[model samples]
Target: MRKLYVIGIGAGDPDQVTMQAVKAMRRAEAFFVIGKGDQKRELVEVRTAILAEHVEGPARVIEIADPPRDRAPADYTEVVRDWHERRAELLEAAFDQVEGTGAILVWGDPALYDSTLRMVEHVLARGRSAFDYEVIPGVTSVAALAARHRMVLHRIGEPVHVTTGRRLREEGLGEGSTVVMLDGDCSFTEVPGDDVRIWWGAYLGMPDETLIEGPLREVEKEIVTRRAELRAAKGWIMDIYLLRAAEVRHAES
Candidate 1:
C-alpha cells in the first residue's frame, strides 16, 4: 500500500518547517500541492520553496487546483460538505496517476483549523482505500503570534477560546480568554475597545511580519490601516490575535 504523509510546513517562513516535516518531504516519492486559484498563488509558492530547499531525492511535485467553495447560502453545512466531496474527487484523480509515498504540505499545523486532514478522511470514506496516512504537526501561527507579542494565551485558571472572525463579529467577543484567526476584516472593532486588550500579529513567522499590541481603543485604528496596507502589498495575509477582558486581569490582582 502507498503511504500518504500530510506534513504541516508552518504558516509562512521556510525555516518554521519542523525537522520531521522536512524528512517526510525528502522521503516521499511524490508531493501533492494544493493551488488556491490565481489569487492565492503565494500559498503554492511557499510550499514550492520548501520543496526546493528540503527535498533532495527523486520526488516529483504535482500541483492540484483546489475546488472553489460554494458561497451560496443554502444551508452552510451542506454547501461545505458538497464542496469537500468535489475536492476529494480531484485529489483521487491525482492520486490515481501517482504511486509510492504521496505527501502534502499543509499551511500551519494540520491539527489547527486545517481541512487537509478532513479531506483525507473524506477520501478514505469514499471507499477508495489504498494507502496508509500519517499527519506530521507543524508550528501554528497562533503560537508564533503569541510569542511575538510576549503574552500568554490563557491565564492559569481561565478558559481559552479559539474562534474565527466571523463568529467574533456575529456573536461578539466572549467573556473568557479568546484567540481569533482567519479574520480578514477588523473584527476586533466589534468588541468594545474600552474593555479589552489585544495582541495582534500579521504574516507571522515571515520576514515582513508585523505585531501590534495595546488596549484595543488606543491601537485599533493603527492596526486596521497597517493590516490593510500589508494585505494590499502582499496580495494575501494571514493573521491571528488574542483578546482578554480587562476585568480578568483585575480579578487576578
Candidate 2:
C-alpha cells in the first residue's frame, strides 16, 4: 500500500518550513499539489520554493485542481460538505496514480482551518484507496502573528478562542482573547467595542507581510483600506488577526 504524508508548510514564509517537514518531503516520490488557481499563484510558488530548497533529489509534482467552493452560501456547512466530497474524489484519483510515498503540502498546519486531512479521510472512507497517512505539523499563522507582535495569545490562565471571521461576527466576543482566521470581510469591524485592541497581519512570513496594531476603533478603517489595496494589488490575500477586548482582559485579571 502507498503511504501519504500530509505536511504543513507553515503560514506563508518559506523559512517557516520545519526540518521534519523537509524530511517528509524528501521521502515522497511525488508531491501532490492542490492548486488554488491563478489568484493564489504566489502560494503555489511558495510550495515550489520549499521543495526546491529542501528536497535535493528528483521528485515529481502532480497538480490537482481544487474543487470550486461557494464563496457565500446560506447553508455554509452543507456547501462545505459538498465541496469536500468533490475534493475527496479528486484526491482519490491523484492517489491512484502514485505507487510510492505521496504527499500533500498543506498551508499552515493541517490541524488548523485547513481541510486536507479531512479530504484525505474522505478518500479513504470511500473504500477506494488503501494507504497509510501521517501528519507533520508546521507553525500556524496564529503563532506567526503572535511572534511578530511579541504578544501572548491569552491573558494568564485564560483560554484562547480561535474562530472564523463569520463566527466572530455572529457570536460576538468571548471572555478570553479571540484569534480570527479566514476573515475576508474584516469581521473585526463588526465587533463592537472601543476598548478592544487588534493585532492584525497579512501575508505573514513573506516579503509582502504587513502588520497593524492599535485600538480596534482607531485602526479598523486603516486595516480595511490596506487589506483592500493589498488584495487588489495581489489579486488574493490570506490574513489573520487577534482581537483582545480590554474590558475582558481587565475583568479576567
Candidate 3:
C-alpha cells in the first residue's frame, strides 16, 4: 500500500514550517500541489520556495489543477460538498500515480478551515484507493495574528469563537472574542456596535504583512481601504481578524 502525508506549511512565512513538517516532506516521493492559478501565482512561488529551501535534493513536484466551484450559491453547504467531491476525484488520480509516498502541503493546520483532509477522506471512502496517511500540523494564521499583535486570543477565562466572514455577518458577534477568516467582504464593518474592538492582519507572516488595531468603527474603514489597495495591487489577499467588545479589554486591564 502507498502512503500519503498531509503536511501543514504554516500560514505564509516559510520559517513557520516546522521541523516535523520538513521531515514529512523529505519522506514523500512527490508533492502534490494544488495550482492556485496565475492571479495568485505568488502563492505557488511561496510553496516552491519552501520545497527548495528545506527539502534538499531534487524532489518531484506534481501540480494538480484545482477544480472550480461556486463561490456563492443559495445552498452553500451543498455547493461546497460538490466542490469537495470534485477535489477528491483529482487527488485520487494524483495519489494513484505515486508508487510509494506522496504529499499535499496545506496552509494553516489541516484541522482548521482546511478541506484537504476531507478531500483525502472522500478519496478513501470512494473505495478506489487505499493508502495510509498522516497529518503534520503547522502554525496557523490565527496564531500568527496573535503573535504579530502581541496579544492573547481572549481575556482570561473567556472563550474565543473562530468563524468565517459570512457566518460572522449572519450571526453577529458572539460572546468573548470572535476571530473571522474567509471573509471576502470586510464583514468586520457589519459587526455592529462602536464598542467592538478589532485587531486585523493580512498577508500574515509574509513580507507584505499588514496589521490594524483600534475601535471597530475607528479602523473599519482603514481595514477596508487597505484591504482593497492590497488586493488591487497584488491581485489577492489572505487575512484574519479578532474582534472583542471594548468592555472586555477594560476587564482585562
Candidate 4:
C-alpha cells in the first residue's frame, strides 16, 4: 500500500464519528480490521455499519486474524511486547496482499490502551513494507463517560488521573479525581474508604448502554454485580469509571 490511515471511530456510538474520520474513511480504498474474533463480532459490525452509513459506495474490508496471547500474564510488559510483534507480522502480511490507500479502524482512540498504532509502527520498523500513514482522532470513551454523567473531570485547577485497574490496585487513588479504564476486576471495590463516590458506564453508546453512580461503598457491589451480569449476557464488556473523594469540597462557583 502507498498510504494508510489509522482512524479512531469513537467509543462505540456511530453518531460519535467525526467529519474528519468520515473524510479519512472515504480516502481509503480498503480497511484492514484486526482483533474481531467470534466473541466480539459485533464490534467489527459496528465499524462496517459506520462505513456503510458514511461512505459513498461499498468499502472494502480485509480481516486479519489476531494471534492469541496470555490474558493473565505473570510478566505483563514482556508478554504484551511479544504479542505486538506477532500482530505486526500478521499486519505486514495482510498489507502486502492489498494495494492502494488503506485504513485501520481503531476502537476508542489509538493513543489510549489500544495497540493498533504500535503494531503499525512495528510493521514499518521491520522495513518489509513502507507506507505513509496518518491518524484521525475521534471522541474517546473518557469523554463519552464524562458526557454521559454530565460532570466535569476534576475540581477547580486540580488534576484528573487516568489509570488502569491494575495500577489503581497497586498505587491506590491519585490526588483530585481518578478515571480508571481496562479494569476487569472492579478495582473500585478495592479502593479504600467510604468517602469516595463513583460514576461508571458500560457499552457507552450501544443500545444496551448502562450507567451507575453513587457513593463507592454503597454502589460498588451493584456495579460489580451488573458488570458480571452484562458480561455473562453478552460474552464481552467494555467499561470505564471515575472516582472522587466525596470529602473534597465542591468549591463554590
TM-scores of the candidates are 0.92, 0.96, 0.97, 0.96
**Which run of 10 residues does model 2 get worst, by summed lDDT?**
244-253
Q: What does candidate 3's lDDT look like per residue over 1-253, in tens digits?
A: 7999999999999999999999999988999989878888888788889999988788798888888888889999999999999999999998888899998989889999999999999999999999999999989999999999999999878899999999998999989999999999898888778798999999999999999998988889899999999999999999999999965334555
* Clash pairs (backbone) in predicted model 1: none
lDDT of 2 at 8: 95
Residue ranges of candidate 4 with Cα displaced over 4 Å: 247-253
lDDT of 1 by residue, 1-253 (tens): 8889999888787888988998888778888998887767878877887888888754587888888775545687888888788878778778877778899889899999878888888898998767899999998988888778877888777788899887898888775788999887789987866878899998787778899999999989999999999988978778899998776335555
Order of the predicted models by lDDT, top scorer first: 4, 2, 3, 1
Give the range of the ten consecutive residues with the poorest summed lDDT in model 3: 244-253
Alpha-carbon lDDT of model 4: 0.93
Query: What local lDDT score does residue 93 receive in model 2, on the 0 to 100 scale?
Result: 96
Looking at model 2, the pairs that clash are none
1-253: candidate 2 lDDT, tens digit per residue? 7899999999888999999999999999999999989998888888888898998865688889998988899999999999999999999998888998999999999999999999999999999889999999999999999999999898887889999999998999877899999998899989987899999999999999999999999999999999999999999999999998875324565
Clashing pairs in 4: none
lDDT of 4 by residue, 151-225 (tens): 999988889999999999999999999999999999999999979999999999999899999999999999999
- Report lDDT (CA) for all predictions: 0.84, 0.92, 0.92, 0.93
